[model samples]
Target: NKQGRRQSTISLSTGSGEPISLSMPASGERRLAFMDLLLKHHINGGELSEEDIREEVDTFMFEGHDTTAMAMSWIIYLLGHNMEVQDRLALEVDSLFDDLHSEMRNESNSSSTTEITLDAIKQLKYLDCVVKEGLRLCPSVPLIGRSATEDMTISGHVVPAGTVIYCFIYQLHRDPEIFPDPEVFNPDRFLPENSGGRHPFAFVPFSAGPRNCIGQKFALAELKIVLARLIRHYRFVSLDQP
Candidate 1:
């Protein structure tokens, strides 16, 4: 009734007359919690129910934390095995600092504060390639669930409507034709020259098309920041090295 989209009923009933725990306190602390926001919206005649609120909150917490943790762990492990790559990344980060300080030295004629800002971090082209390669090798979500909306033929196989499909990202990433020496940890593989003329779907760590991960950009940026900081200070060594 509010907008074009149908809103869930605020009246706490699970359709089967079963009691659902969606207790909203009258007044409490500041607007910090999800439940607080839900209560506010409900009071304002917004139609999202307790289950809706809970499900949304759970998705946010679970998906955000778990996936990011997995990606970071994999990136760290990959870096450990590839000291040369880590060293190169660190050098690039240092060069950025040097460039910044040089510009400041010319501007104010004194040493400047060398801090990595979001804008500056985004400019790290080599680092960007490294992270992309890492993601291609070990996507946090190794598989994505999708269903066909219409009948289609893929690789000569007719896929009927309503057919549930699981795209194996990990296996696809290792396709020898698309990625030669697929098991190798080569950041250069993601370089512009190498990536050019390649199939777009060949390297879809964040999935592809309209249903691709909504948090891909945020997650990649977070990964870059963390990896940049870590590489700058510590030289991670492989424990398996004899």
Candidate 2:
């Protein structure tokens, strides 16, 4: 019970201990419990060992929490400066929840029983458009690096093998052909009519293909839930000049 004693000691040692204790959950305890569950289920099994779990936890804790927090910050900043977009998002969320509620009633299910289904979240097209456009404008990780496995020719220039390549996602997102009038904060660019014909690599916020993020879906779902809840409760202020 070292963890319990440590928490208790920390709680008693501080001047503003009550607030600190209230503000922060016992993360150590929570993490241990999560690990116990994972071990019980043998979730990682042969794919990962104890050391692998440590490394994965380190990577995920840093990448997942920091990147998502930064993304949400950018989204808030964008929404604050774009009233029309915020209004549209709010309306979309309202309509989706109303429809979801109706569907639940028709199915004779409790609200808790009717979880946020993939189809339901997919139907939040406008909200999804806003998120896509936000990522296009201010991607969380602005740049990424890769090393060449073999000699390659890019733009007719032959590059030696094992060369480090820095891909600028910011510049890619600003390409005129890929995103017409790319500087504009227009979510309509992600509309089904406009997006259907565009090149797939035009938007690589979460990178692309096999090397892409495994938590992309989880991240997007978390974002949508937070945004939907926030919009339903509060109308965001637009701080930009007309």
Candidate 3:
């Protein structure tokens, strides 16, 4: 996927005739960037065509920019109205960071530094639960659609091939059978002790399957990092009347 234009070049022209090039990144310099990965997939003949790469890039931009921001907004709103949950999550984040700093101090003998790496974020267990419950309560994408690839019988109803199936994520997440007191913003519902045997499909905010969102992990990591930093620095308060 060298930007050197070795194998192929693709571009789109605007009404003004200005070409927008899908310039490839330099070779052997994969920096874990999304565009670089998309270009690599395209240049390496890895099942992604030029058009597919274009669509993927567009989708990635939208999801990364908009939906993830929406998720954070909803999580902050939930935390605002529920200060108890916010305080508890903040405590978890603080404890983890303190321990991380202590480890750094011991390693450095005299100096201590903090970095919010994946390992550090993983220890913020309560923060993880808070994000999950926020998503369950207010999914950024409230619904997802899929088409049946083959004929299937679902609870006596016949679903033929190519039949479009739509999943209402909001309703599914609020199923009283799956989530007791569904309207409540209880992050503990996602705690391992309380979530021992929940259905896999009970909470699919991003939809579950092979075709599921590719950015889910990256989005969650971003959420944790941003939320961790925000909660540590400031407390959110809802000024609106409930």
Leading candidate by lDDT:
3
What local lDDT score does residue 57 receive in model 3, on the 0 to 100 scale? 61
What TM-score, over all chains together, does every model reach?
0.81, 0.75, 0.78
Question: Judged by lDDT against the true structure, how good is candidate 2?
Answer: 0.75
Angstrom error at residue 55, model 3:
0.3
Model 3: residues with Cα > 4 Å off, grouped in runs: 1-50
Measured by TM-score, the strongest candidate is 1
Q: Where's the lowest-lDDT run of ten residues in candidate 3?
A: 1-10
Query: Each candidate's lDDT (Cα)?
Result: 0.79, 0.75, 0.86
The predicted structure with the larger lDDT, 1 or 2, is 1
For 1-242, candidate 1 gives per-residue lDDT tens digits of: 22332333444444498755444444543343675577667656757666677566656765767788888888788889988888898999988878987998899998788777788898898899888888889988888888899999999999999999999999999999988999998889888998999989988888899978788888888888888778777888879876
Ranking by TM-score: 1, 3, 2
C-alpha displacement of 117 in model 1, angstroms?
Answer: 1.7
lDDT of 3 by residue, 142-229 (tens): 9999999999999999999999999999899999998999999999999999998998889898889898888889999999999999
